[model samples]
Target chain A: MKKIIFGIAFLIFFSFLIVSAINMRTFGEPAYSEMDDYFIENAQSETGANNVVTSVVFDYRGFDTLGEATVLFTAVVGVIALFRGVKK
Target chain B: MKEMSRIVKTVTNFVYGFIIIFGFYIIAHGHLTPGGGFQGGAVVGSAFALLLVSYGSLNSQKFLKKDILSLFEGFGLILFIVLGFSGLGITFFYNFLANSGGWFGNAAVIGVNPGNMNTGGVIPLMNIAVGLEVLSAFGVIVLTMASAAEFTKKKEKS
Candidate 1:
């Protein structure tokens, strides 16, 4: 019974993924790209980073990086706390 | 937990240095090249994991100090926040130093030419900061997990 349920769920999920993949647009050509065009054109001069991805990650969307760092910090804290009593 | 076999130790010893160096290169060249802080830091952290796995927790404890990792983790995060706050004269995380003809402040090279290191303003700094944070965080996590696994193994044995 469990196997049957899992098989049904897996088929449903797989079909959903396959449908999304088929409906997706062509490779290297996204449907909405105005932001991409702006970044490609202006990122270098605006942020002085030749790497637009870095500029986007660190400068244009810096808050996201901060949040990422915070998340990492929290994870470390949690891991260490969990293992503290196990220290030899 | 005991160390791995000699072959694993030998391979780890040979490859870890190069892995660390490559990670640093990725972080330092983040603004000019493809990878950034997170990618480079992950590479270095995997090197740490490799060392821990080969050497085990007891021997690895000497080199992989938890206090130092915590210190660096906190320091890197604080440095990032400070860097952002320093630019508050304009706004948070503002690129105030770009094209200003100072340290890491030069006009970016146009077109498809070789990029310079002394450009990109706070991007490189942020990259380094984030790289440091990520490396230490992953190190701490790996170390903690290894220690926990040792505990579980002992519990099972007893």
Candidate 2:
């Protein structure tokens, strides 16, 4: 009975994934791309970075990167705290 | 945990330096390449992991000191925050250096010709900062976990 239930759940999840994949927008064509168009056109001149993705990451959406750095710092702190009792 | 066989050790010794250099290259070229700090850092971190696995955690501590790695991690995060705050005269995280013809301030070619390294304002700096933080963070985590595992294994054996 558990096996049957597991199989059914897996099938349902797989079908959902397949449906989403089939129905998803075409590659490189987003549903809303006004912002992308603007970035593509202006990022080089404004940020002076050839890679638009990097400009978006480090210049335009810099707060997110800051948060990511904080998260990583916190994670390292937590790991060190957890292992404080362990001997070298 | 015992160190891996001499073959793995030899291969790792031969390969880790190149891995680290490649990772640094990716971080330095992040503004012009597909990879950025996090990805490049992960590559370097994997080199540390490779070293730890081949040398064993206890033997690896001499080089991969947790104290120094922790210091670098903190330094990287602080540097990132400082860079972010430096742009506050205009706004937080502003590209104050771009197109200014100062350090890392050359205007990038309007379209793709050949990528310029000195073109991304605070981005390259941020990439280096984040790369350092992530690489050292991973080293500390792996080193700590490996030591902890050794401790647990010894306790179980006793």
Candidate 3:
């Protein structure tokens, strides 16, 4: 019974993923607008980093970076605690 | 464990040094390049693994103890949070030293454009924090596994 429910969930997830991928293919090459040009031109200056993606991840979306780092820290602490064992 | 030849140990040591240097380079240039804290830390961790495999677990532990690694990990986390909070008034992770117009600013500068490197706000410092945490965490993982294995072996022996 559990296996059957899991199988259904997996099928639904895959179906949604496939539909999203197909929909992405239908969109034509996005037209380069002034914002795109600006991002390309001044990415280094504005973000203060050479790697554009790093700038995007850590600068423009700094809140997201904080969240991600917090998640990583939580996971690390969890793992360490798990290995260390619990004392009643 | 099987004993490796002297030639193999020498070669492996050379490779390990190369990997460690490359990882440091990646972490240092993280602001400028594709590689960053996670990638570089993994690389360094792999180099330690190579040392354990080629040399021995005992030798590996001599350099990096479990407690020391944990301390380093905690320190890195604290450093990251402190750096983040330092940007409170302006923005989260703001580079306070970016335009201080002092010797400290000049020393902290990176890239061909000194001022620009400082502009990334708290990104570089954050990268360093992440790198230290990752490297220490990975070392802890290896230590945990090795210790577990040793415990199992002792139990079997008894």
| Predicted structure 3: lDDT | 0.70
In model 2, the Cα lDDT at residue B33 comes to 93
What local distance difference test score does each model get? 0.92, 0.94, 0.70
Q: Provide chain B's TM-score, model 1.
A: 0.96
Using Cα atoms with residue i matched to residue i, what is each candidate's TM-score against the true structure? 0.88, 0.90, 0.75
lDDT of 2 by residue, B1-158 (tens): 68999999999999999999999999999999999999999999999999999998878988889899999999999999999999999999998999999999999999876788999999999999999999999999999999999999999999
Error of 2 at A75 (Å): 1.1
Better of 1 and 2 by TM-score: 2
Q: What is candidate 2's local distance difference test score?
A: 0.94
User: Clash pairs of candidate 3?
Assistant: B95-B121
The alpha-carbon deviation from the true structure for residue A46 of candidate 1, after best TM-score superposition, in angstroms, is 0.9
DockQ-best of 2 and 3: 2
Q: Which window of 10 residues has the lowest lDDT sum in candidate 3 chain B?
A: B102-111
- Model 2: what TM-score? 0.90
lDDT of 2 by residue, A1-88 (tens): 9999999999999999999999998888788989989999999999999999999999999999999999999999999999999876
lDDT winner: 2
**What local lDDT score does residue A68 receive in model 1, on the 0 to 100 scale?**
90
Return model 1's CA RMSD, one decimal: 3.3
* Number of the candidate with higher TM-score, 2 or 3: 2
- For model 1, the superposed segments whose C-alpha errors exceed 4 Å read A1-32, B156-158
